[model samples]
Target: MTPDLHWTVTVDPLTLAIGFAHVQVEHTLGHHFSLYLGPSVKCFDGILEGANGPYVGVGVEAGVRGFFWGTAPAGGWVMVRGVLASLSTNVPNTATNLGGYTSALVGFTGIVGPGLVLSGGLGVSYFDYGVLEYGVHGLAPAAHTNVGWAF
Candidate 1:
């Protein structure tokens, strides 16, 4: 077990692999719960390219997590997260895409070594936005994972 950590910041590797930069930061709210905020931005053009131009988006992810037992920063947990975003093209005349994403998941957080942290969860993901018209959104069983250092 690692020492008590008040804040944890994690980056989603899968998102980075696909050109999106995503990160989440969580702070302990006593022994049973914590709150997190994640800001995501599209930094690459290959993923959402349009004939007119490339597309970009800025979004926020926020959620609350419940620790099943024991202290936070480690052990089993449950989370409910919501994401709201707007996507638009570099071209001036295109319409902007907007929508919300929400998920409920169960997962585990562990201190693999010292203050290093690894977390993974499985859940369903939903999205209803103009972006989906471009076939960019998927309604399927999804899983999420992240790696970071806790301090």
Candidate 2:
């Protein structure tokens, strides 16, 4: 077994309207085919105009990543990752509520320079806000890109 560590800074272009970003620490387990876990912080500044705009929120994100091409901790690989998060927000004059989202993605990870890596993927997202009765009714296109430093 080989263990690898990385710090990642992520952005989802599609979520730009809502101002979403993620910061995560990843730990990889196993050798040939790695299984990884990421603990993350998700931050958002607003929502779609129709839903509500200019409200800030923060969430905790958890993710699992599987690399099929080869070992992790080093090298290039093809990966699939699943992410889940829960967030709470308050809008001025509006009710405070909590929401959650999940994503399933297919991507690639490549080592660029010493201790540096880049990863990106396309996926679908499902989001729900129980209190507001508002959500992404079905699967919506999602994309993610991240730059990381591994040690």
Candidate 3:
């Protein structure tokens, strides 16, 4: 079993900035099943204009790892995760009915080393407004790279 901690900063396709701090645990689940779970802090620029707000999120990823059509340090994997985020904004003159959003993410991560990894994926989010006739849809594309030092 290998455990790692990672910090990721993601910019949405519309230039909204988001950041995450996460912990991951990876291990072989028999032959082709691996699992990862972690909690994170999710922040968005559009929600706060430029300041980051805090929201709790969790995710699970499962896929196969190892070289399939290449050599060492190069492999393919697929992952899917869901996040529920909440933020408070001070922006006036707009509809203040929306305060939270739920997002679903699906992406792939490529192995780069025994201690380093790279991943990129896309996700869509929906915001709900109570008693309102309108909502917002958001699209986010993210990339992450992390290096770990085992102890």
Candidate 4:
């Protein structure tokens, strides 16, 4: 059989406008488990409250997927990922500042169709508020619907 190659694109509606995409190559282990890993990229562009200004950044992400549902290509799965990005903001009356955020998220994965995966879960995030000094750290709800294409 040919190797399995799939690409998935995901987005979060709660975080203004944050999205991610990745390409995964699936490797079947025995007859009931599958493992896939790939490089992912995430980006954001929107408004920022306070003196910090607009929020914008590009983060490189690494993700892993594990499927455990017999030989069926569509079923339940899980994912864990980490993201680190270089971020900056343009605050009026202030110099261009630099900051970044690191996040770790885990979610339950489900396949809805021929090539669709729906993942949703909760995660904790740490944000460094650049010049603001005071950062943010808390638990947040995360959800994403990804469409995959296998070939």
Candidate 5:
């Protein structure tokens, strides 16, 4: 069977203009489950209210999928996958009052592929805003979606 490769772009709800790229890899793990790993780059829209500045973050996600439709060659599958990610960003020295922060996010992704797949899902993120802080703390629920090619 041929392998599946795809690129996913997700736009954040809070910062609609800001988006991230995920390089996705899919592998079959038997009859019911498939494994996927995505290394991503997330860009923020310059800290909230000018408290800090925009920063780039690096992270990775690992998840498994349970397929519910069609098979390998026919080209359509509906699968649910769970992902966990750790992201880090640097705070500018000019913003000494602000410190670097890391975030942990967990989310469920549903993918349907038939040449091009429509992807959408919801997630909750918990940020440990080290030095620079604003708004709420701990966990926040967010949603995302994207349209991209699937192969």
Candidate 6:
């Protein structure tokens, strides 16, 4: 990380492909620690269940990261992240679903150019749809890559 760098704004393309516009912002707290949070807007359009009709919702992610090598927001890092989402559909009299996941991830962030930041990571995520109606709760493989500008 640049000595004077304080913030970064990043986007996940994979999340966009799946119908969520996800963007994250990271801020350095010290030489080895940082905090990141983001929001996601989704339009599933009943991709998972036909009866649900159009599925729309919002999601959020908050996490703390620790850098073991290099400086904050650069080189190797580990993070514990928690995500939450609330979704509802066009179906009448249906309850909105609130779900999210928590993950532990390891990755590296590098500056490709002057201010271009690139990052990738893999980890296991514990996701609980937060509704027994969906019976969706488990540990799943997680992967992510982000491209952004560091300043």
- The lDDT for every candidate, in the order shown, is 0.73, 0.54, 0.36, 0.44, 0.43, 0.76
lDDT of 3 by residue, 1-151 (tens): 1233232222222322334444444444433334444443333324332224322222322223332322222234444444343333444443333243444444444443444455544455444312132223344343434333211
Give the per-residue Cα lDDT of candidate 4 at 131.
39
User: Candidate 6's residue-wise lDDT over 26-122, tens digit each?
Assistant: 9999899999999966654323342123556678888888999989888899988887889766667888898777889899889766679898888
Cα misplacement distance, residue 61 of candidate 5 (Å): 2.2
Candidate 3 structure, TM-score to reference? 0.42
Which numbered prediction scores highest in TM-score against the true structure?
Answer: 6
Residue 7 alpha-carbon offset, candidate 6, angstroms: 0.4
Summarize candidate 4's per-residue lDDT along 4-105 as a digit string, tens digits: 423344444444343333444444454434445444433332333321334344445455555553232344445555455444445556453444344444
TM-score of 5: 0.49
The 10-residue segment with the lowest total lDDT in model 1: 45-54
Give residue 61's lDDT in candidate 4 (0 to 100). 49
Worst 10 residues of 3 by lDDT: 7-16
Candidate 3 ranges beyond 4 A from true positions = 1-17, 43-74, 85-137, 149-151
TM-scores, one per candidate: 0.82, 0.66, 0.42, 0.51, 0.49, 0.85
Clash count (model 2, backbone only): 0
- In model 6, the runs with Cα more than 4 Å from the true position are 45-54, 130-136
Candidate 4 lDDT at 119 equals: 50
The C-alpha stretches of model 5 lying farther than 4 A from their native spots are: 1-16, 44-52, 68-114, 129-131, 134-137
lDDT of 6 at 51: 17
TM-score-wise, the better of 1 and 4 is 1
Backbone collisions counted per model: 0, 0, 0, 0, 3, 0
Higher lDDT: candidate 4 or 5?
Answer: 4
Q: After superposition, how far is residue 66 of candidate 5 from its true place, in Å?
A: 2.8
